[model samples]
Target: MQQPQDQTTTLQKTFRIILGVFMIAAAVGHLSFQRSEFQAQVPNWSPLSKDLTVILSGIVEAALGLGMVFWKKQRIKVGIALAIFYVLIFPGNIAQYLNHTNAFGLDTDAKRLARLFFQPVLILWAIWSTGALSHLTKKFKG
Candidate 1:
C-alpha cells in the first residue's frame, strides 16, 4: 500500500481549507473596504508608513492564502511560513491593544485585550492545519 503523506485527518483538511478562505477574505478586507481598520493594527514604530505596510502585508496575505489553498505539494512549508507571518505581525496586534486604536469592532479595552489572546490560536491553526507542527516535531525527535 502507498503510504499517505501528512496523514492529516478529514477535520484537519477542512480546517486548512477554511483557514485559507478566511485568509483570502481577510486579504480582501485589508485591500478594499477595511483598509483604515487594518491600518489601525500597524505599529507606529514601523519604518514603513501604515498604509504601505498594510498594502504590502495584504499582498503577502493574498499570496499565502493562495498557496494554502492550492499548494498541496508544500503544505508544511506554507504552514510554517504562515505561522511565522502571524508571529511577525503579532507586535502590531499588540500595538493596537496598547495604543488603544479603535478598529474591527474591538472598541473597548477589554475587547482589545481579549483579541490579543487569539493570535496564538491563529499561529497554532496555521501549524496544525498544515501538519507543520507534526513535521517539525518529528524532525526534532530524529
Candidate 2:
C-alpha cells in the first residue's frame, strides 16, 4: 500500500517540474530580447555592469531550472539552492520598486510594490514543490 507521504511527494515532484519550466522561461527572457527589461531590475548601485549581471543570472537560472527538473536524486539540495537564489535576487526586486525603474509591465509604484510580495511566495514554492521542507524537517529532527 502506498503511504500518504508518497502521494504528497509525487505531487510535490509534479509541482517542482512546473516551477522548473517557469524558471527556464524566465531565464530565456533574461537572455534574449527582453534582456534590457531584465536589466531594469538590476540595481544602479550594483558594481557589475547591468549587461553582465543579466547574462550571468540568466545562465544560473537556466542551470537551476534544468537541475530542478532532472536532478531527482539531488532534488532537495537543488530546492535549497533555488530557495537561496530567490532570496538573493529579492534585493533586485526591491531596488526596482524603490528606484522607480520599470520593467515587465510593472509600470507604477503600486504594481512594483505588489510584485515585491511575490518573492516570498517564490521562495516557499521552491521549498514546498521539492519537498525540501519535509526533508529538512526530518534531517533536523534526527
Candidate 3:
C-alpha cells in the first residue's frame, strides 16, 4: 500500500526519479542501439511501418520520461499518461509471445510470457509513485 496524502513520501519521489531515468534509457535504446530489437516487438497488424512505430514510441517515451523527472506539477498526469502508454504497448508484448518473436534476450516463450506479467507492475509503479493510484481510487470512492 502507498500513502495517499497530498504530498508524496521520499520513497515515492525516489522511485519516480528512477522510473523516469529508466524510461529515458529505454527511449535511447529504441532510437539507436536497440532499434532492430525493438522492431521485433512491434505488432504486425500495426498500420504504421515497424520502424515508424518504434520511432514514435521512442519519442513518446522520451517525452514521458522528461515529464516524470522535471514536470513535478504535472506528474500525476504524467503517471496517468505513462500508465496508459504501458497499456497501449501491451499488445506488442503479447505479439512477441504469441508470434514467438525473439528479441531482448527473451528468446523463449516462457521468457516472453514472464515479461507480460511485468507490464502491470510498471503500470502500478507509475500510478503509485505519482500518487495517481490513491488519487484515482478516491475519485471513484463515495
Candidate 4:
C-alpha cells in the first residue's frame, strides 16, 4: 500500500502532467489562429516587427509547450525557458489590460481586467507544475 506521502507525490505528478498539457495548449493556441492578434497585443518596446513577432512568438511558445514532454532534464530546461518567456510577455499582457487592446474576442473592459489577473495565474501554475517550487524549497531548506 502506498504511504500518504507517496499518494501525495502521485497526485503532484498528475497535477503536473495536466498543468503541462494546459500550458502547452495555451502556448500553441497563441501561435495558431491568434497569431495576428498576439502581434497586435505586443507593447511598442518589443523588438520584433509585427509579423515577425507573431511568427517568432508562435515558434517559441510551441517549442516550450513541447519541451514539457521530453526527458526530465529537458523538461527542467523547458520549464526555465518558459518561465523566462512568461516574464518577457508580461508587459504585453499588461498593455492589453491597460490600453484595452481587444483581441481574441476579449472586448469587455471587465474581461480585460480579469485577464490581467488570469495571465499571472497561468504563469504561476506553470511554475508550480514544473517542480520549480520544490527546487526552491529544497534550496532554501538546506
- Global fold similarity of model 3 (TM-score): 0.95
Ranking by lDDT: 3, 1, 2, 4
lDDT of 1 by residue, 1-142 (tens): 3222867878888898899989999999989999999999999999999999999999989988988888877888888999999999999989999999999999998999999999999999998998888888888999
Q: Write the per-residue lDDT of candidate 2 for residues 28-123, one digit (tens) a residue.
A: 999998899999999988899999999999999999999889987677778889999999999999999999998999999999999999999989
Quote each prediction's TM-score: 0.95, 0.92, 0.95, 0.78
Report lDDT (CA) for all predictions. Answer: 0.90, 0.88, 0.93, 0.67
Point out where model 2 deviates above 4 Å: 1-8
Model 1 error, position 40 (Å): 0.7
Kindly report which residue stretches of model 1 are placed more than 4 angstroms away from their true locations once superposed. 1-4
Clashes of each: 0, 0, 0, 0
Shift in Å, residue 85, candidate 1:
0.4
Over 17-125, each residue of candidate 4 has an lDDT whose tens digit, in order, gives: 7766765676676667767788767887777776677677777776776666553454445555777788888888788877788887878788877877776776665
* Candidate 3 lDDT over residue span 20-127, tens digit each: 999999999999999999999999999999999999999999999998899888888899999999999999999999999999999999999999999999999999
User: Where is the poorest 10-residue window by lDDT in model 2?
Assistant: 1-10
lDDT of 1: 0.90
